[model samples]
Target: MWTIGLGFVAVLVIYFTYWLNKWSNPRCNGVLPPGSMGLPLIGETLQLIVPSYSLDLHPFIKKRAQRYGPIFRTSVAGRPIVISVDPEFNHYIVKQEGKLVELWYMDSFSSLFSMEGESRTTALGVIHKYVRSIILDHFGTEPLKEKLLPQIEVFVSKTLETWSTQSSVEVKHAASIMVFDFSTKSIMFSYDAEKSPMKLSEKLINVAGGFMSFPLNIPGFAYHKSLKDQKEALTMLRKIVKEKMNSPGKHEDMLDQAINNMNKEKFLSEDFLIRWVFGISFATFEAISTALSLALKLIADNPAVLQELTAERKAILKARKNRNSILTWEEYKSMTFTLQVINEVFRIANVSPGLLPKALKDVKFKGYTIPSGWTIMIANSVLQLNSNTYKDPLAFNPWRWKDLDPSVLSKNFMPFGGGIRQCAGAEYTKTFMAIFVHVLVTKYRWTRLKGGNIARSPLLGFTDGLHIRITKKSS
Candidate 1:
């Protein structure tokens, strides 16, 4: 009887070993990257949830990449996630011929965007194609140079007028309003700043950002509040769309164009349009505001850089005969140092710290097998600050752009992400950030307020509000 019992125990041990091996191995044929995933079922969820995770992930991913090579798997939310940091791997993932992977986690964004049914899956793709085409047609560089610059100048002037009177101001809040107004007017061709439909739209964005972490709606929870907020936001958007549809004026703005010129095959419903517009607005606001705050903080800390940029701006303005007008896109693009500064800011700020991609099939890499149904995260924080890609990765050196080949920079840069799902607002965002930085540096001189540390905000932007004392620069 004792011999039989020992043999059974040995059999059980063998079965458990087989199961563990299956669980730990990557399914795909390629090399799997290396990383330690904490205890069972929980994975890295706790580490990711902590506010300091952004800062922590950089070092952790870098160490893993050094040990594991480009692609690796670790557990997240009770599932295995393959993280890819190699430029070649990233290119393969992003630039694949067709839909590489379905963005399942983006389902969370569906609730935020108020997309339902099939619309949720396809809304982002439709909006991307539509907005890119329309924006290029209407608000392209030439038009922005000729028409939008004047509009921006007027808007900036109005903003300065109001801000000049305030003793102390929250820069992020103020910048948020400014970007919101600019984006709304630019997209809708409306200048009714106070009564603009974008006010509630902005609130919807806030709700979306805050709602993601809350438990699923079981009634009377934070998720419920987000659902309610989302409904209110959609109602406002619908009202605006209905008003635009009824008005018979030649459709000049994006809203009108979307409603009038939609491709039946890919055309979005009116409700989809409303939610997309809001989504786009929020994305624009978040990217631009965070970029602006970072720029401000950088300028405040590096007086010499600020002086150089200011001098460059002065020289450019002087060469243009002191026009005292907003810089056109052409003019903005010519500000090479400004571009470098913004790029550096993005590198350090590292917004959109990671990309979540769901696996469609079992894929193997680096001796590990990542099974299907597992969600993969490409941690940008790891790649952006990797010493192999960036020298003095922590320092804010705008001139680093000058040192590297443009091709290398493009390949290594994960700021806007890569692949088919790259940020749709990349060009618009760059333009907005350039305009914002130019205006702030040229119009005002600011110093960081004593006892203020500009830390990462809990909301994925700068946390400290970037308090600075501003004194108008003498013309």
Candidate 2:
């Protein structure tokens, strides 16, 4: 009887080993990146999803990259995810010919943007290409030179006029409002300071960071509140779009341009128009606001750098001989210090830590296999902070760009991202930053508050609402 029991146990152990070997081995083209899926169903979810898990994923990813080399598989939210750090592999995933990547946490945006129409899943590649072209054409460098900069100056003048009456103010919230106004004016062409229902939109974006990690959207939960806010924001956006469409000439904004230029065969549906407006508007608002806040905070912390930038702007303005004149693309490009400042801000602040790229088929690298249907995150945070790429990565040094070769700088710097789906608003963003910085530094003198540590919260924008006392600088 004992021998019989031992024999049964031996057979069971052999079967288990065989099953484990089959499950662990790379299959389906056998070229997938190497890494473990761990246990079934709940792989790596615990490690990646903890609430206090650092948003700066460098330490974790760097260790993994060192351990597994370049490509490695792990689980995130019960889904197998591959992480690639090799620049070549990254280029392939981001730019080279391959399958289109899906936004894994798309529900987060759907909740925030209230995207509740036909799934974009089926037509993602087509939609991505079309939207990219539209944004690049309208919000590109030339368009900003002709249209956006003038609008930005007007907004800044108006915002400063209102702030001049107040003794002391929070620049972060004000910056957010500035970005919101800019986005609305640039995209929708009309905005009422008191009438626009943007609080819901703000709330939805705030909570969007929390979705996909928690199953809290089941009513009475924080995620549920986020969903509600998202719906409300969407309703507001829809109303605004419909009104603008029906009213015709109430305002001449991006919406007007889009309506005029939209291909009937491509963006035919009003629903698509609404989504485009909302998506672009939200992304622009968040990125610009955060960037501006970081720039301001850095300026306050490093007054010497700020003075240097101001001097350069003064030189540029002197050469142009018109403070009131709008800057052309050529003129804007001439201010290299302004570009350096913006680049430095992006490096230190590092907003939108990374991007998730999905696998189309099993791909191999460094003897590892990343199976298809898995998600991978190219961690920009790690790349930006990598010691090998940038000297003193944490230092807010704008002069770092002065001596660097342009070609080398381009490879190392990826604030807006890289590849085919890189930021459509890259040029517009740089131009906006230049104008904003030029205006603010030339006009205002700001002092950091006592005991304030600008480095404590570096996620871009005023997570704490930058409260600075400002005085008009004497001419």
Candidate 3:
């Protein structure tokens, strides 16, 4: 009996050792970058998700980059992942979309979109380009100068007016709802809580951080609630799409653009169209709202930056013949400092920390090989937070961008991402944030009331909500 028990214990030890070796070793033809894969199935997932108190990049990426260098290997949630903080490599990877690599989202992130069936793999590349082209037609630079700019300005002004009247407001929650209301119009139709009973925005609020969370669909987890919230939002979105299809009028939003092209484009099927609209709406809302919220917190905390920002906005308004007149393309263009502020905010905010692209085949970079079926996280946030590039990397200093132009989308500072697959809404996001800061500084003043804590569950957000009491400036 003693001999049998000892033999069983020895077998268990051997099994554990064997599995540990497999997890640590990369299954590749060539050498792999150095980094720990952590425990077997879990594989550093908990460490990756563990929040860092600082506003800088997550400690998981930072410490690994420090110890293992810019490009490192690790397994995240049972998936082998190569994290690249090297700008040159990230640029190469993103540009290689459809060739050496392809667009990839984790199960948790992809589940939120609910775009299953044929749209999953082969058609993904084509669908991405198709949606990008149409969205550009409606929300691109030309559209901004002609129409969307004024629309955004009006919506922001009216929305802030409403906010100023309230006692205290959560910047993130209020901005999410307001931005959702505004962007959803361009995607489908107008969203008015009073006019429509659908709680799509509210559902989406729950969907925010859940996309980047671990792909656990079990109850009592954020991933589960996120998927549930996404389903609810999709149902309402589909209902709206069907109703729109029944109508003869052209709304001129993204849905109308898609519907008009259904015959011209085979990929714009009803299913894909619905999912695409949901995606665009979320992109526009999330990117702008998160940045806007973060910008306010930074500006509020840094009085000098706030003073300069206020001066820039005041100067823009002063140059106008009528202060009440709508902001012009030329005036928007002249907002050099304001644009710098936006860039700096994005750099610090790290709104979109992780950009995942999967390896299509064995690809060699430097001395290491990235095996096919592995995911590469362009940990741009890690790169952005590098002290070598930006002085006082963690501090909010828009003036640092004085010599460096923020307008040029480079590998070094891509809050909206970079390369061919860079966010199609890049221009739209910058425009929205620029105008948002302009309106914020010139028209109103705000005080932080409560809840300023922040975190990144792989998605950066105000953990307790950035609550602030905003009021209109006195005449």
- The TM-score values for the models, in the order shown, are 0.79, 0.79, 0.90
Candidate 2 residue 169 C-alpha distance from true site, Å: 4.0
Q: Write the per-residue lDDT of candidate 2 for residues 301-398, one digit (tens) a residue.
A: 78798778888878877887677686666777788888888988887666765677666556565555666666777766666676687787778888
Candidate 2 deviant stretches above 4 angstroms = 1-58, 97-125, 164-168, 190-193, 197-215, 218-222, 244-251, 257-263, 320-330, 450-465
Deviating ranges (above 4 Å) for candidate 3: 1-17, 105-125, 190-193, 212-214, 246-251, 405-409
Give per-residue CA lDDT, model 3, range 1-475, as digits (tens): 9999999999999999887887789678999888888888888988888776678778888788889998999988899999998888988888887777776632223343434455444455656677778878888899899998999999899988999899989888888888888777777764556587767788888898677677788999999999998998888878777877777367467787777777766556666666766776777788788888888888888999889888888888788889889988898999898888888888888887768888878889999999988988998887677787777898889888877644433768877777777787888889988888888788899999987777875668777889999888885
TM-score of 1: 0.79
Model 1, 1-475: lDDT tens digits are 9999999999999998776666565454654556655555666655544354343344445556778776766775566777777666666656531244556434433344443465433665654565567766555666566677667667766776677677766676677778777877766764366866456645755564553343445666656777777777778778878888777356677787777764442445665677667776676677677677767876778877888898878877887855675565567778999889888888887776567776556545435555666676666766677788889787888988888777777767778877666675676677777776677777886776743344432235544556666778777
> Scored by CA lDDT, what does every candidate get?
0.66, 0.66, 0.80
Lowest lDDT 10-mer window, candidate 2? Answer: 450-459
lDDT of 1 at 349: 76
Instruction: Give every collision pair in model 2.
Output: 31-363, 31-364, 32-368, 32-369, 32-370, 33-368, 33-369, 33-370, 34-368, 34-369
lDDT of 1 at 210: 56
The lDDT-based order of candidates, best leading, equals 3, 1, 2
TM-score of 3: 0.90
